[model samples]
Structures are given as C-alpha cells and as structure tokens.
Target: MRRIVAALGASLLAACSTPPPPERGPAPAPAASPPAMAPAAPGALLQREAAVWRAARWDELPGWEADALQHAWPALLAGCARPAPGWEPSCASARALDSPDANRVRAWLQQRLQPWRVEAAAGRSDVRAEGLLTGYFEPQVQASRKRSAAYAVPLHTPPADLATRKPWYSRSEIERLPAAQAALRGREIAWLADPLELLMLQVQGSGRLRITEADGSVKTVRVAYAGSNDQPYRSVARWLVERGAFTLEQASWPAIRTWARANPAQVPELLASNPRYVFFREEPLPDPTIGPNGAQGVALTPGRSIAVDRRAVPYGTPVWIDSTEPQPWSPTPPPPRPLQRLVMAQDTGSAITGAPRADYFWGWGEGAEDFAGRMKQPLRMWVLWPLAHTPGDAKPISTR
Candidate 1:
C-alpha cells in the first residue's frame, strides 16, 4: 500500500492578535428577491451529508478550562507554517505570541474560536456523530547496523526503480524470488531480530530504532515512512482470529508473540498472509522531544496531536475530544477515567475515514505503547474554528 509521507518542523504562534481586514468597496443595493441558493463549495458540507453543526458555548466544552493547553502549543505552531484556508488569520495572530503559558494560550483560543458540535446527518436514523476513538504511537525497537546471527531480519529501503512499478513485490515474493531479493540486496537500512516487531513498525508507518553501531556505540534514530509497494494491506491478527487461534478481544502484540512461539512452523505462512511490504528511510533526531512528521507536515505533540478525517475536520483546526479510557482486556482493565482535552487535527490515516473517528498520538516508548494498544472507546468531538469562518450557508445555532 502507498503510505503518505509528511514533513516535520517547528514554527507556530498563539492566537492572541487580530488580522487586518480586507479592503472593501461601496456596499451594493439589496437584492430585489432573495438570492437563489447557490451550490456549496468544495469541502463545504461535512461528509456530503446533512451533518448538523450546532454552535456551542464555551462552557459546553467539557474540561476546557482545566486542560493544559501549553502541551499543544508546539503542534499548533508547526501547523501555522502551512496554514489552511480560513485558518490563515488565526495562524498569523499566533505567530506573534512567544510565551508558552497555558493560561495565556487557553485565553487566546477562547477569545478567537467558535466551537461547533458535530451531529449525525438528518434522516439517517441509524447514524450518530459519536464514533470510535483509538490511539497510535512511535515504537522503539532494538536493531543493528550489520546483519548478524541474532539480528537476521533486514529492514529494506526503497529501490531506485520503486516508482517505475505499480506494485513492486509481495512480502512472500521478496523473501522467495531471486529478482525481488536482488532488488533489495544492498538497500538494507538496518537489521532486526523479530520479524513480527518489524512488521508492526511497518503497520504503524514510523518508529524509533535503537541501533548498536560498528564500534559498539549505541545511538537512536528515527525510521519514518518513505514508501511502500502498492499491494493491499491485510491484517494477520484478523487471520489468526478467523482461524480460531484466538478471539478478537485477545489479539494483541503479546498474544501474537505467544502464538508465534507455540506455532513456530506457521510463522512464514502467517507473515505471507499479508502481501503488502513497506520500505523506510532513516531520519536524524535533531530534537529528541519532537515526534515523526504527521500527515499535516508538522511534528506531533505527545498528548495533543490527533489523526482526523480531513473531510470532516480540516487540518490545523483545534478539536475538543470527550471520551473515556479504553477498557482493559485482561485480568483487570484500567479504571475508566475521563479523557476530555484539547487536541489538534494534525495528522490523518486510512482507517480514520469518518467525522467522529480519531487516532490519538501518545508519543513514544513503552508507556505510550501500552496506552495506544488498548485505546478503543466511544468518542465525541467539537471543532474550534475561527469565528468568521463558515463552511457553507450553514449558520451557527448559537455563539459564545
């Protein structure tokens, strides 16, 4: 499958200032009859349905006053570098503020933005704006510069002629075919131990690799989404579930590893079930604090960056998420706590297709992985846009 590649950088400001107005000419005469209703422009209607956007008061946004807005400051600023339409004014104002104070940032947002509640399209009795919320994170894996007995699996880079072919080669073909093997002979970026871990990294699109160098010096580097063969993606876990190896609820990284250990002979067949293959490129870790590039071309914030459907919520827009922690699937799940907070629509994913769906970024390492792996719960969202911004002819029901 072809994965999207995004650029990362830091360059955003807070929305504490106002933009200059556009120069206008003399007012025109009133229309003799009400103007005919015009067709909506591109990206006007949310999801091309009757999705109602009820304007909300600031107080209606749950936990708005208590959230630590400073955490999302970096993500907002990075998005400002490539501000979207209807967002340029707010981005410009934000560029002028340098302070990272949470109170000041929260105040600026309250002053300039109008929050709208996303509702299901009218007449669709079965639909509701509320949908599933999940999480994804950058995983850290151990690797080596040279292919050793311990680290036998190799992570390949895109070949010189990768773009020339429509679908390069399937994962099985690459391992079995001579021509496919030749194409990736010298394109190894790094070697890893577990094939399952490498596949997980590819599925997530990006991750951090902890490598031991030739001289025994260890260093950490980012392996971001470079490109992939255009084959379709299939879930091996789903395959396991269908085969009765485990139930859907019991499917996870640890469970999969246990299955692999029990059925060592089926490892190759399990991997070959999915035809898609991903190639990666190493990136420099300039600022260890920042994360890999998101679809909006900005560095993601640990708790404040979320992947949203671009058609429903435009990139660079502020989104308020009201959800609960996912229920644990084991001996005991974590207590269901409120996950209300402010986050930015700074990324996107193929699976995130609807308006209410979102994938929260939880940063990197084990803690993030643990949370991200289990985050699948119901979600409600409120989009904060510039007060003057309007999607189409839809007027705000109320304003704060």
Candidate 2:
C-alpha cells in the first residue's frame, strides 16, 4: 500500500486494526527514555496551501492518552528514515528510544511534539475540520508465469512504445485490438485467473503476486507501479451505480464482485468501463511481514501508515486521526466502532487532495482488502509537529 494518488481515480487501501489495540489494564507510570531535544512550546494559527492549523493541547485529541502508541512506534521510526525538514532533532531522539512500553512512548511524544488541529481552508471564511477518510491495501493475488486455463489474463511490464505515444491505448482498446496486444506480447510478468483481481491490483497501483515460475518453483514477488497508459481514470464503482447495478452506497468491492458473478457476461464490459490502465514491474519480496513502501520511501506499517495531502500534512509527521470504522448501509448496521489513533503520514494519493483528506493504509491480504474496500468515513485529524520548531520555521518535505 503506497501513495495510490487517487481514491476514485484509483482506490486507496485500508484495514481493520488501529494502534495495536490499546494496552490492557491501567497505564503505568512514565518510564525514562533516551534524552530528547528541549521542548519548545506550541504556537497559534498557521496556514498552508489548502489547510489551516490551530495549535491545540493534547487533551483536545480524542483518545490521545488511551492509544497504545508502541504499535505506532515502527511507523514513526520508518518515517524517520527520511525525516522531513525540522524533523531531524525529533527523529534523532526517536531513534534512541528502545522501549516499546505504551507509557514510555506516550511520554516521549508528549515531551517533544505539539498537536495542531487541521482544518480545510474555506476561501476567506471559517475553517472546517471534518474531512474524508478512505482506505487502501496491497492486494495479494495468485499468479502463474505462463498462461493456462486457470490463469489467462496477463499483467505486463510497460510496452516498448508506452512513452512514445501520449495517452496510450485505452484498456478496452488494449483488450480488443491486435496491434495493442502485439505491443504487450511476451511482456507478461505473470498471468492471473481473475480479471477483477487484476483490475483491483491495477487500481490499487501495486500488489503481491504468489507466482509459480516456469521451472515449478513458487515465490511471492511484489508488482510495483512502473507506469500507466496515461489515460484519464474513471471509477468502475461509479459506472456500476449509473447502470443501476448497485446504488452509490452499495457500490463496494464485495458488491461489485457479487454482481460480476451473477452477470458473468457483463464482467468484461464492466471492467472496460474504466479506461485507465496501469503497468507494473516486479520487485523481490524479502520480508513478508513488512508492508510495501509508501510515497515516503519507507515500508508502511499495518494500521499505522496513512496517506495525506502533502500540502496539509508533511510526510513523516505523526497524525492523530479521529474517525469511525466503516459502517454498513443496511437497516441493521452495527454500532460505530471508534477508529481514533496515532498514525504516520508516510504516503499521499491523487484523490487525497485537501487538508482534511486522508487515505488509511490497511497493509495486505483479503481481510485488509475487504475492510479497505468498505472504508469511506468521516475524518478529523491533528498533526503532531516537533515542539522544537514553530510552524513558521517548518517546511513541508518535497517528494519531487
């Protein structure tokens, strides 16, 4: 689950867990950790390209003390690998922290960070804190090196002339034309059985392939984003809604898959409805437990990494997000589960454009995919900046 760049243009991934489930029993007394920088006090209102930030006390953040931040420790450390401007001092101190205790981590953060409530810029009017939260996941699909009855669809590397042509062939043209097919001939990295899964992989921008090689050895590899055909992206989910296949509220991935099964003949047409096509290049997977690299160039932590607009929140910043888990649309929908917790801003997405918007990273697997697919919830966020620097002194880290 990297910086997917779009929620509707391309779906962001999400998952079920948040901050490793709070530590059981009462919180212990703060334990001593490595020395940190002298805490600088927080400041007042600040403005960014599309957001407004108001300095706030930690108590203002919901579940601030309740979250077991030890689970978020890995993500914090990961972000430090490429610390943003004004983050060097904090990152240095963070690297010295060895304890995984909830109280200890909490104390470290409180000592060195300032919480700022994020609000959307409302064009010379008041600021609004509420924003959208979506989820993204790294899809894991079974694949084969060679085409077979079970694995017929091909996932390819970039075509030879992919860059020569601006806005290359549409997905429908690629599937329907021989010249387009010829350009991709013998370029297949692996073949998959379910076209829908392949489409999901493309939409998600990256995936894990459990590939059976031609020599009969099987290994899991990551198929990362190489390039796209540069076509305009259209949402298949929206297309389904327009065609009366499912209502807007019911257009989740599961529902789409169900509709595909019932109307097998229409599956191709349904998939082709989204003209955008993505290409991939496989990478070696040495660590299965670790997640895919985000836009920050660090491996994502399950339930801990988030995709945010760089304009509002810088990469590597710790964010305290207050939101509820995805709720069903049915009459008997379950109670709203609180999704408040500490997360790292390590990625960004295309649809993740304003100050309040975010795409939660759910890591990988079927459970992640399912949860991420259904995650479209209201979000409120607070960015934790290093207390040592004022908002005026801190600059957003450039990914370009």
Best TM-score goes to which candidate?
2
* Per-candidate clash tally: 3, 10
List TM-scores for all candidates, in order: 0.81, 0.86
Residue pairs that clash (backbone atoms under 3 angstroms), model 2 = 5-349, 5-350, 6-350, 12-135, 12-136, 13-135, 13-136, 13-137, 14-135, 14-136
The Cα error of candidate 2 at residue 139, in Å, is 1.4
**lDDT by residue for model 1 (226-330), tens:** 777778766677678789987666655566789999999999999898787878888888788888877676677888888766667776778899998655576
Determine which window of 10 residues in candidate 1 has minimal summed lDDT.
7-16
Please report how far candidate 1 places residue 44 from its true position, in Å.
12
lDDT of 2 by residue, 294-337 (tens): 77777788799888877888878999999988766786898889
